[model samples]
Target: MRAVAVTAFGEEPQLMDVPQPEAGPGEVLVRMAVAGLNPVDWRIADGMLKDAGPQSFPMVLGTDGAGEVVAVGTGVRRFTVGDAVFGRFWRPAKGGGSYADLAVAGEKDVAQAPRSVTYATSAAVPTAGTSAYNLIEETRAGEGKRVLVVGATGGVGTFATQLAAGRGAEVLATARTTKADLMRNLGSAATVDHTAGPVAEQVLAAHPEGVDILIDLVSGPEEFGAMTRAVRDGGTAVSTTGAADADALTEQNLRGFNFHNRPSPQLLEILAGQLDAGRLTVLVGSEVALEEAPEALQLSRTGRARGKTVIAL
Candidate 1:
């Protein structure tokens, strides 16, 4: 099997021949049609999870993908050969991932891909969508709440903006001036030009009264703390990038936490249903073949990608 993997943590990923993975108990073997790229893909390849999770050399590096099930391990009854499925695929303990011709996933993180969605779209859903959903769930954002999404043009930010809007929150999204229309189309009530200066100042100017919830995606601890000032008294602030100052925010009587997403099949199904019902959209900015993924990943690391990038097999 052909896979893109790093020989060791912090090593460059290369196209190399590796042994194909097979289904184990409660797992399904998938013939990947497409793989989705996320920041974590490169982060893990660079050994971001060295202490937090298992690590292996020659480790494949994709976490989300869509494909056909070619075989199922014993006790797996929900899927069989030829079933179209998609979901999170990386398991550091296993060391294998979806950046290959074939991958394996446990039943808990796998779900049937609806026919209404393309393999490319399905491949893009798991990580960003689930993370967005989890963030919204934790905040309990909804009607009348004023919500702000920083870094609103990336994959997870795009989904978070839409989901926050769908939940009836008045959404303010941060993006470069060029993406103003895109943010508006995604249901943001207002768009802040993050590149101009401090986003908190821009947002504060618009909503004189602080927002009910703040979701910051691209800030460090200091910047995130400064941004939390825009959260109204008793409001909530969460950072998906592990930048929240929880103790300080708590002392100030505001809720704050760093978010970590836990993906599951049920969440994927709910997101897929929204896509099917025309309530959700997955914005894929580009598609490349497996051989071109390395370059695409490099380009994406610039942190300016406007939408999801999928690697078509």
Candidate 2:
């Protein structure tokens, strides 16, 4: 089996022939069709998790993937051979990952892939979509609310915008000039150009009373403070990237928190239903072969990618 792995933290990933993984108890072996690249992939490669815990050297480097089940392990009854599934494959402790041609995931984390979308698109949905769902749920944004999504052009941001709008909130999103139309097409009622001027000023000009919910996908300390000011009193502010200040959150009448995405079988089923109903869209900007994962990972880390990039096996 061919896999791209990092022999050491901060080392370049190398494509090598490795032994194929087998299904353990309550796990299912999947013949991977595509792998999704996220910002976390590059962070892990750069040794971001070094102090947090131990990692297996020569560790495979991917979390989200879509493929067909080749075998099911003991105690697994939900899936069988030939069933199509997608989800987070790598467990932090196990070190096994979806970057390989074959990988194993616990039956609990896997869900049937949407029939409406290709495997490449389905591969892009699990992590990002689940993150978006959690963000929306945390904020409690719904009907009649004015929700703003900052950094609305990236993978999770795009899904956040659509899901917020679909929930009956008036969605306001930010993107570069090139992606303004794309953002609007995805259900944003208003779009701000982040490259043009200050994001805080642009958002305030559109909604003078402040928004009911502000979701910041990309922000630093200063940028986050400015965006937090755009949230109305009693409203919520959520950050997916670690950009919120606890002191400021207490001073102002704002609730602030960050999100770490967790995979849920129920959430995956809901997202799959949305995709099948043509209510949710997975925007895939590029598709590369498994051999090109290193390049794709770099592109995702640069924050310049317009949409999700999938690694087709």
Candidate 3:
């Protein structure tokens, strides 16, 4: 089987002929149709998470994927051969990932793919979908709440905007002018042109009382702190990039925390249900063949991505 992988951490990923992987106890082996590219995939390859856990060489570099199950291991009763599935497939310790023709994942991280969409779309949902759902739940975005989504055109941002709006929150999404219409179409009540000026200024100028919640997906610590001004006292601010100063925000009479997503099979199933009901959609900006993954990975580092990128296997 052919896969895109690095011989070692910090090495560039390349298309190589590697041995196929099989499911282990409590795992499932999937013949991948598509693999999703995420920012953390590149970061892991760069050794930023070297201390996170043990790893194996010739490590495959994809986190999410959609495909057909080819085999199941002992104790895996929920899935069978030929079942269509989508979810997390990154097992660095086993030198396995979704970039290959076949990948392995713990059963708990795999779930039935949304029947209403193609494999390409389902492949893009796991991480972004789960993150958005968990964020909305944590902040209780709903009727009467005003939620602002920073980086609202990116993968997780796109989902977050829709989910927040679907729950009846008035969504304020930050995007470039080019994506203003798209964001509104995705349910943003208003759009903030982040490129024009400070987003906090624009948001506050329109919503004087401030939003009930802030979901900061792209800012650094200083910028996140500065943006928290858009959240009213007693409101909440959540940062996905570890940019939140919890104590400092609390001192300002606002609730703040660095968000950590907890993805689960149950969440994936709910997202799939949303897709099936036509209440959710996946936005795939680019799709590359497995062989082109190397170049695609390089382009991801440019930080200009507006939507999800998928690798067709």
Give the winner by lDDT. 3
- Candidate 1 on 1-313: residue-level lDDT in tens? 8888888888888888888887899999999999999988888877788898666567888989999999999999899899999998876666668989999999888898967979999999899999999999999978999998988899999999999999899999988878999999999998989889888888888878889999998888999998987888999999988998778999989998999998888999998888888888899999988888788778877887759999987
Candidate 2 lDDT over 1-313, as tens digits, reads 8988888888898788777778889999999999988888878877878787766667788889999999999999899899999998985455657888998899989899998889998999988999999888888877999998998899899999999888888988988778889999999998988899887788888778889888999897789898887888978887877888766886897888877777798899999999999999899999988889998887777798869988888
Model 3: residues with Cα > 4 Å off, grouped in runs: none
Question: What number of clashing residue pairs does each candidate have, in the order they appear?
Answer: 0, 0, 0
Superior candidate under TM-score, 1 versus 2: 1
Deviation (Å) of 246 in candidate 2: 2.3
Residue-by-residue lDDT tens digits, candidate 3, 60-178: 88899999999999999899999999999988888958899999999999899998899999999999999999999999998999999998999899999999999899999998999
User: Better model by TM-score, 1 or 3?
Assistant: 3
Task: At residue 190, give the lDDT of candidate 2.
Answer: 87
Q: What lDDT does candidate 3 reach at residue 233?
A: 92
Error of 3 at 15 (Å): 1.3
